[model samples]
Target: MKKVLILSTALTSVAMAASAEEISVMSWGGAYATSQIEAYHKPFTAQTGVSVINVDADNPAAPIKAQVEAGNVTIDVVDLEYADAVRMCDEGLLEPIDPAILPAGADGTPAADDFLPGAVAECFVATIVFSTLYAFDESKFPENPPTTIADFFDTAKYPGKRGMRKGAKVNLEMALMADGVPAGEVYALLETPEGVDRAFAKLDTIKNDMIWWEAGAQPPQLLADGEVVMTTGYNGRFFAAAVAEGKPFKQVFDGQVYEYDGYAIPKGAPNMERAKEFIVFASQTQQLADQAKWIAYGPARKSSGPLVGLYQDGKTEMGPFMPTAAANLTNALPSSYEFWVDRDAELNERFNAWLAQ
Candidate 1:
């Protein structure tokens, strides 16, 4: 068995060498991956002749930690949330990415200066500013659409199964917001035991009516298949389905929780050099801006903002749909990476136990 496995690996390696160098990048699949593929992978492959093999995970951060600890790292680069990036870097699970390797913005500003605040961390280079927002099928509530976070929890009025991600982070915050706690006070309130109870109690309101999802791709499909009427999902996925695929979806940006998602190399990735090259290439001004065309995620670089224009359909403007847009910011909450980094494990454990009950 060992011999056969070794021979298979050897033959695969030989084949790869004869064809092209390939780096595996694990990301949340669906429209998000498609955006990266169009904006980064194809262009990078064309420029360097190093093919990119895309991989998907429910959460890329988990597999990265497992692979590094097991001494069998295979993924060259992973897309991760800011908190996971910071946590893994602190735990020595990821490679330290030097900012010097990144290119200057289109306007000639240094990479460090050009990227938005907290966009670059010790182990990651933030690529996009995305949001976790709930959207409903237009067909679900035709007369009166869900316009606010509170409306999402009003199952009595709306009358349908709700979709939520199978995790604690966004759900807790949303629960607080839906319960009428101001966005500014969410994390502060969450710091107290009473506040935690309040959030959980609010979540209990829709617990029975909830359909939990793991992958970013699931929510759109859940909505499409009529499995759910309204679901919290990455804003980009909703944009792709509604705009690109012409599905009957509508984004409810009110009380949206936005965060940075970026690329990090696991400590011992086989193609370290290629991974670095890919990161630098993908983090460039044009590439980041180009990504916005395919999805609603905002580029992390300030220079890229001006470059973002129409969507892939070439008619719809992308600016108003972004989480960073002025109109969208009215009821938005920027996720605190520091808060999540500190409490992720304890909260997740509590969340799992709550789910089991």
Candidate 2:
């Protein structure tokens, strides 16, 4: 009896040790986090017995920087926007991720070649190509529905409160686009003093009626709760609400600003090896494609494109909803990471000053 008791105690301790292994992934919450949970976390835990604990943030970049700078890094993995990833990597706040660790495409192409251009960075591995676009509650605009970027700015014609992100990046670009600046000319114009003034001048038109949102999740909720008739939000969030939840929201791809969002290990991560494994598993071709079923964001892997099928409901095709869809690209702008890397600080200062007025 004594021998049996000793063996039982030893077995339980081993089981507890195995189950205690977990990695923390910080990401933008709401529907986007759900997608990662379904497509990445669950499968990863099942395969490796290493659990994933999700940490939500309005934007993970700010917290990550703070964590790294303070030398108390709690998060093992972080989802970062492209420009933030580049900036943090340059500042040595993130661990260097070797592309060689990533698996090849389903078609057996090398990861370096299989990934979309700029998808694999020195310290980041992009998972999706998401777009920031404006969405409207269909019931709010039953007649003469908005169809252009300019329509989003026409308060007199639309007659409702507008929802926008409380940041300068997309707002400035969208303002220029609405003011009739071509997609190709937006960045060039933004570099000039007169152009920066012009963009703000356009925003001044709707400043009073603007309902600013800082999180990706808030825009859809603002529209659903009738706080705003039209709002800008991530394409995936709107798609999740409109399709999965059966909301009457409609997205306008016109003047959409699309960029890559992906995973990076924070410097001095406690679970560095496991974090790398999670990133490799999450960014696999099939895994990337599977994420599309849960959200409208395009997979970063080119091979994943053909494998993308229907939504989780198994009816609505996801191709046409992707930001990379041919029709949607007709009037879209690929976000410029280089431009943001150079001007984020100064422009944000100007934006904050304008907000105070």
Candidate 3:
């Protein structure tokens, strides 16, 4: 009896140790990360008995690439934009996620059939559809309020510094649209050298008045502190500040560029199985719907749409604020993943040289 008791105690300890395993996740931090924490991370941990260590990256793609190429992969999973996800997959920096393992939708539709068009990719499973939109402090723009993308570059009219991401992707697209290129023609024109120059020339107009931001959290802070009269940032970040924190920020949906942000495992993540498990758990229909309650981003799953309604506050409707809403899409542009996947390196190089000059 004494010998049996000792063996039982040892087995239980081993099981407890195995159950306490941890996985590191990297993402764009701020209310976005908070929404994932409340909707996906906490519930996943509670259900699986696995510990999640969350980390922030200005852009998870950059650090994830570095970590993978260095052969020192610490992050098990990362949330990345559609283009970055596709680019990374092409570079073989990420592990391929199998659609077979993903759960079916709440209404019994297959995973492949249920996700929004282009949401699921070879290397990543998309979680949310978000937009890069500019926001302003209402107090700063009361008289002649800035409304359009052209106004974002009109420093003489708005008369204050503007906050833009420290990257060439969305800015270039917005520049073209602001400079009178139709949203439909923006990418087609950008395929040429002269068109690239035109976009940069538009950007040059506001270069002196620009304050560059990397993290999603910085724009709201910059707006609230009166450091910038207008700033381009994720729509959800502005929503959190305006609705949750009761800040006076207002999003400029005109010329907003919408895209998907999703999950991908590093090529040689330490906790591959557990990371895959987390993805499966978080990508379920109900889980995706739950995320919208915390942030205004539209869930990637179509089945999750009807289920989405109120914000976590329980009174504010989240539909009209979503980037995919018909009202918001009238003047909006859909970000082209293929364009960025092929041109990201070259354009960013030119962008860097332009910055230096």
lDDT of each: 0.95, 0.96, 0.92
Cα lDDT tens digits, model 3, 109-133, are 9998999998999999999999999
Give one digit per residue, the lDDT tens place, for model 2 in 283-316: 9999999999899999999999999999999899
- Compared with the true structure, model 2 gives a TM-score of 0.95
Model 3: CA > 4 A from native: 1-20
- Model 1 scores worst on lDDT over the 10 consecutive residues at 13-22
Clashes of 2: 0
Q: Which sequence of candidate numbers ranks them by lDDT, best first?
A: 2, 1, 3
RMSD of 1: 4.1
lDDT of 1 by residue, 153-257 (tens): 999989899999998999999999999999999999999999899999999999999999999999999999999999999999999999888899999999999
Deviation (Å) of 10 in candidate 1: 16
